[model samples]
Target: MANLDTALKDAMSIDGAIGVALVDYTSGMTLGVAGGTPEIDLTVAAAGNTDVVRAKMRTIEMLKLNDDIEDMLITLGGQYHIIRPLTGPTGKGLFLYLMLSKARSNLALARHQLRTIEEQLEL
Candidate 1:
């Protein structure tokens, strides 16, 4: 298993990764972060995405979907945002948020890589 710093480092190594953060949706706090260009502020992005996660969870409960969120994707003109809620035993209210340059990333592969990172991440 990898510690938070190591996991963040691994995430940054992924192709097209612009920034990555481990966020706590319940409190809208960033537990750890790595990478970010002048164009992006990973802390702000992570906090804002907490709303997205909360809204989706509320919707699921209200609708009685009986489903769990695996991840949420937001695609922009130049980037792709991936929000994956951690499902491991110790990761109850946390998520992994990653931003990738659309032109440089392969969405499918990125998703796969993120999943692997999630599995290995030790919170």
Candidate 2:
């Protein structure tokens, strides 16, 4: 199992990864973060993305979709942002956010690898 430090390091190792953070959706606070560039403040990014996750979840509940969100992908001109909410008992209300260079990242592979990392992460 990977601790927060190990998991953050592992996230940084992903191809094209620019930054990664573990955030609390309820409070829009970051629990852990790694690899952000000077132009990107991961703490701010994580907090903002918390709203995205909350909005989606609220929409789901309102629509009575009876579903769960696996992840959210936001593609910008040069970046790919991935937000994955953690679902384990201890991980509830927490999420993992990953930023990747669109030109270099394999979206499918990154998603798969992130899933693996989530599973191995020890909260």
Candidate 3:
């Protein structure tokens, strides 16, 4: 299993990866971050996304859906944002956030890679 630094580095190796972060959903804090350009502040993005996760969780609870979220995808004109909540006992309340350039990224492969990284992550 990899530690946070290795996990973040692995995330940055994905095709078209622009940035990645390991964030805490409850506290809106980033545990680790990598690969963001100056124009893209990963820290701010990570914190802001905590609300997105929280909202979705709240919606699921209110709707009484027994399902769990695997991940969330946001497609922008030039970018794809993926939010994957960690599920292992040590990873609860945290998520892996990945940003990719739409033109260069293979969505399916990136998702698969993220899943692998999540599995190997040691928290």
Each candidate's clash count: 0, 0, 0
lDDT of 2 by residue, 33-58 (tens): 99999999999998889889999999
Off by over 4 Å in 3: none
| Tens-digit lDDT string for candidate 3 (48-107) | 999999999999999999778899999999999999999787898999999999999999
Record all residue pairs in model 2 with backbone atoms less than 3 Å apart, i.e. clashing. Answer: none
In model 1, the runs with Cα more than 4 Å from the true position are none
Query: What TM-score against the true fold does each predicted structure earn?
Result: 0.97, 0.97, 0.98
As a TM-score, model 2 comes out at: 0.97
Backbone clashes in model 3, listed as residue pairs: none
RMSDs, each prediction?
A: 0.8, 0.7, 0.7
Q: Give the better candidate number (1 or 2) by lDDT.
A: 2
Best-to-worst order by lDDT is: 3, 2, 1
